[model samples]
Target: MTSQASLSVTAETQENTLTEVFSLQKSAFQITPYPSLTERKHTLQLLHRLLVNHQQNIIDAINNDFGLRSSDESRIAEIIPSLQAIHYTLKRLPRWMKPKRRHVSWQLQPASCKILYQPLGVAGIMVPWNYPLFLAVSPLVAALSAGNRAMVKMSEYTPHTAELFKQLITDNFPEDLISVITGNADIAIQFSQLPFDHLLFTGSTQTGKKVMQAAANNLTPVTLELGGKSPTIIAPDYPINEAAKRICFGKSLNAGQTCVAPDYILLPENQLNLFIDAFTAHFQQMYPDFAHNSSYSHIINDRQFQRLQQGLVDAQQKGAKIINVSDFAPDATTRRFPIHLVTHTNESMLICQEEIFGPILPLITYSTIEQAISFVNQQPRPLALYLFSHEQDLHDKVLVNTHSGGVCLNETLLHVAVDDLPFGGVGPSGMGHYHGQEGFQTFSQAKSILKKGRINSTQFIYPPYKNKAINWLYKLLLR
Candidate 1:
């Protein structure tokens, strides 16, 4: 008991240390003057170098945390995309920083209007457990490219991965420029409340609201990447096999822990069994047997595992059908849980109420496209919405009727990979986007600049608003 107490106290002390480091970094940024464009470019280069050097360590750490994530999947999903973001920013930074010209009215004819891109000082990035490295570091890249210093707080759920990321930053860079913070929620709360110029959070919507409230005390700008129950609509016109393959791939990978994963299916009523059979066939082919495959990742932790368990239970209690997809019997060594297919679940059930961050997918049947669109419209916008339809008209219908952060037509959950497209959410799914050029804008502020020759057309309106000449000038220019 005494030893256990000591261990608990030691853990608490370590958590406090992380918060203190973040606070110090914030203060340092506050004291530093605005960073120059050259400096921003240098920071991005350093970040790119770090990612290249520590690729394997990051992959291994993620694997250790989540059991065994696919090596190629982790690299392509986490690092390659980030490196591309860096390269995209590097190639465009000069152009992006150029002052944007604006039309000045003829009344101010001698003046040229421009908008200068400026940094927003220190930025705090709170990363979620899923896709820890990519989500956190990617945002840091944007902040740095925009000439803002960043303090990253990696989720403690993946403690090993979190520590590895912190070490990577500490070994390569000074804490004043960039660093990783690792701790539990209380310490996260302390770090969140610090007066950073801006804060970027990627996590659940419920906690996102709390982070916003904390940052609000200082009126700090925020970018929230919250997850919602993203729905996938399988248009009756498409091939069931192709649609199933993509849908199952997105839903089964990392056991559907991905925020962008299709949360639930909105299928045509008559085609429910056809879609299920195709989906089940794909799921079987992917694993063959989940009882002993080390390639499959387990739940993040027991707490999360229990939550997944409860969601399945809730679906069952609410008269939802369960279609278990695993040959593995329950055991400790292979903590691999099967995916449940719970159809006809009400919105009150856990499967519908919470973001089902697991393999379990709740399939809802709809007779008409309008019904599915209406149901989806009533919910908060999702991170990504998938529509499987070869027909252009149905695709067009889905696009016009429903709202999401982004969309993938005739595909499932891969639109975020396109660096040219802005990746983020709307209403509830997320706020602000960050991937390529959009990311640069997310962290940059445009300061208006007006350059004028020695000609004052508006001088007559300086103090006296009633001057007839000024009124004539105002009318002519405004018109």
Candidate 2:
């Protein structure tokens, strides 16, 4: 029989390590309590420096993890936005930290009221494999800005990137101030179970449910950035070529591994062929030869690739047409899977039911804008909804009728890049906003404080049978 004693020891050791780290972070946070504005700015500046100085290393690690993550994609999607977020937060942190005064009612004479943004002690972040850098540090940036210590649990699927991130973070800051934890699913569960002040998780909806359950044991507030089938609708009036170009650009970037990437496109019934032609032309122009193109990214790992392959097979077997954009066969060895357009899909097909995280785009045709809107409403509210329309009335109508985390009018995948806008999801997609001012607010506690000096006004209403002053005061207040 195996040694149960050894197993027990191993389990105890892991538990000790997790507790030690949590305790250390908690103690460190108590020591400082609230970090000054200068300290917060310095932390942000250091993070900015870390990203800038190690840009090449980050690109290389992500490429090694993905086999061929586009360097430009990493720079544009990861580095630029991170730096921009830091800068934007730094510029606005002062105002965000300032207390706002409130009006005092006549009933509460000589009292002053204000709201203070205070730091929540410690935070825990669970990062997903896709877009590892941005997802991990974006929340970390917010936590640090709000003057809280954080511990990040990186995804195991991207080992190379996670290990490199661990090294970079360790070298940059103290473990108690900010630490990176790397392990398998068991560790993720334990990490989520920790009684942090707040927990933010970025991953799939199923995993998010488990994490939320674990957090519930501690009553820890959670911010879930989960994934859903984000739909893109091309209005009839919009030019098919422009729509196709932007859609293909958004979909093909990072092999459509992005959380907010267009999952399925709602096409106009009459211009389906023209839209396909234009989409193909734009993809070809962007990468004339995908099999040999280094600019395009591969699926992160074999398991994800197989899931995508199985989903495609399921779609094809259900009489859905699959249009492979490239001429090359998908080789498991290379892992550079090409984009496929699926049409004639029903809810029975796996592609329509689940989130297609890979480079699979299903084109659902609609007869009218109302049909498109209805189709979207029928499903769970998505993280993002893209509408390519020039008509002002249509935009107004669609905006009013639909509910999503965010909307992009005549664009795709670029709204998240805007630092001023709040980025998050709704319903099954996600909960909680984290970007710009919203992000700072997410990690901070808005403590309402009221002040009164030498005023015993409440004494007038003290325990008495029927005091004349109390009756007059009550009548005056009521009046």
Candidate 3:
């Protein structure tokens, strides 16, 4: 068997080579003329075509890895998002890449100033397995648009997908532009430690900490997309059906595995019973037979499935009520997971503290929306917050007061679909934003340029603080 450090060493050596390749690319960026709009658009077109060519393999790989993902989910969540990101980048890149005009101060006179957007050389991206195809391509599209050479470390959980990505790169893109790294966690650890100009990682908070630490070795700017317990709040005033439908859509999608998925709910005590009833009805409606419903996804693997199982078991043992939300008879379905509910859980329980990234949603009742807000504030900031209330005031109040990666007003997890908005978390939820402008800025750097006038003026200010002309000018400016 190979030693633990072997993978790390191999990755380090490989990263060094890739870094040099990107350095040359950067040199080319400055001298060989920047990519034309048509060229960039063509690149996106090529990427889209590549995605379509591998559609069936992608669907099968995703199905094998996460049982919960269906062709529809992959098409919408992965393929379509990638296509949309390409479209978004294509439409906006010319404007985005244009130099931004800067205001010249009166003191500066005829001198002009502008801000230039430059690629950040090579970017090292570490993608998690959840939305392997989309998450990888979404950021890659941004990086490519920003004119940065990219290196991606595909998650080990989805080997088929990773292999497919490697094949695609091998077939189409030159290694000097972009490359893929595929292996286990050892390789990931090493990849993170590379001297990339910038790095982006999408994973758990624990893993994110490790990635940040590794990136610190090179003072590499990092974008972390981590997960925490995101809360969904519902007021008594809202239509219960609407709340249930939206919340259920989020929770049931990917079997509640998304980083922005609603982990738990905070609601009025009187509405708890009714909310659960409506949610159960919605879940049943979505999955008439959860066991075999092709649309309903399974937990990633046996390890995650076991962890979800243990979390529910621990909650049940701690005096929490387990609401059975699955409607299918056990014999009818191949899926082992059931929709589990735990109410009255303590703060210290596994389900309460950690992000419950499964279909099991815990419930907490509050006397008022204020209590719900307070509860959320005490914990680490979440990646997403879902609020359900017809009252515009309550929605506005939460929007103003709460800190989160993003907010889904009066619904759950739909805001991320809005391509105009940036998707990311703050604090424990995550440390950077991506999508739209945020994605572009993350992958590139802002370089400010100041033009000098033909004649040098006020040389008196350069050498000493004692010059009368400079002193008089400074006094006049300050006063």
Taking every candidate in turn, the Cα RMSD to the unseen true structure, in Å, is: 2.7, 1.6, 2.8
Local accuracy by lDDT, each model: 0.82, 0.91, 0.82
lDDT of 3 by residue, 253-362 (tens): 87777888889888889878888899898888988866667887777777777788788778888888888787643221344575776788888789998999888888
Candidate 2 per-residue C-alpha lDDT over 371-463 given as tens digits, one digit per residue, 9 for 90 to 100: 999999999999999999999999999999999999999998899998889889999999998988888999999999989889778677788
Off by over 4 Å in 1: 1-34, 329-333, 463-468, 474-479
Winner by TM-score between candidate 3 and candidate 2: 2
Order of candidate numbers by lDDT, starting with the best = 2, 1, 3
Residue range 394-431, candidate 1, lDDT tens digits: 88888888889999987777787787898898988878
lDDT assessment of candidate 3: 0.82
Compared with the true structure, the alpha-carbon lDDT of candidate 2 equals 0.91
Error of 2 at 296 (Å): 0.5
